[model samples]
Target: MMNRFICIPLCLFLLSVCNPKKNERPNGWYYITDRVEDSISLEPIVTINDFEEIKLDSAENLKGKFIYQITGHVAADCVEKWADATEHSIGKRIGFVFQDEVICTPCINCRIETGSFAISAQDTDIKSIYWQIVRKIHSR
Candidate 1:
């Protein structure tokens, strides 16, 4: 009886500690931001961890597509943020940032509600860029 009581409380405490707040960013995750700080975008509206998968696919014009699927546990919050940001910043640029670098900047056109999105890659070496992002996220 004594062990059960202690264990239940301990489990509850651990669960609470592991539950990340909606505003918290996972370690080394990339985020979307509208503003740049110290020449780099720092504030996180949504993070890479919110996405289920990020992939690189071939496209026309010698470019590649950086496709993302926002279908994980944080999908609701992630979709909300994305829609809000894009809605507010129509015709303005938003950035994808990791650490101190702005990895990609794309102008918002309209409110995006779809869970999937793709950004065109400027580099021809799409495979390398894809691996680089994967490595960066894992290196955290």
Candidate 2:
């Protein structure tokens, strides 16, 4: 079952905390700001950059398939689109880009009121971007 998100400010926390296996993150992951663009307009919106790296944890939740988890300080505005399924929610999708490349265009699933989420790719295309995040982590 999915959990409902409750917002609290002033705390730098993650909803789900799972360390990467052996503390080793694979290639192509990245760290980015939550300031997302409207999927349609592509206009920028000021958003929270409170989160950290997104990693592939386990496949159990995904029918034994691997998926990337975006865990860290989630921002309220980042997930507002998934809070309800109203007219605004209708036909709404969350678009993510890494250095001008599209990461995901997932349909609004649920409110990420907490500060963590996972992205499951229909194809292995995300593998390419995973290394970008790995490089970002290593450079730090």
- Highest lDDT among the candidates is held by which one? 1
List model 2 lDDT by residue over 1-100, tens digit each: 1232434321224423343323222222233324564223334321223234456443445467565544333345544432332223334565454555
Worst 10 residues of 2 by lDDT: 23-32
Which lDDT value does model 1 have at 41? Answer: 38
lDDT score for candidate 1 against the true structure: 0.56
Q: Name the lDDT value of residue 38 in candidate 1.
A: 41
Give the per-residue lDDT digits (tens) of candidate 1, residues 1-140.
Answer: 99999999999999999996543333222334434534333456566656545666643443453543212222565877767767877787765554344546677788887645554435344465456656655765
TM-score per candidate, chains pooled? 0.52, 0.42
Residue 122 lDDT (model 2)? 60
Error of 2 at 96 (Å): 1.5
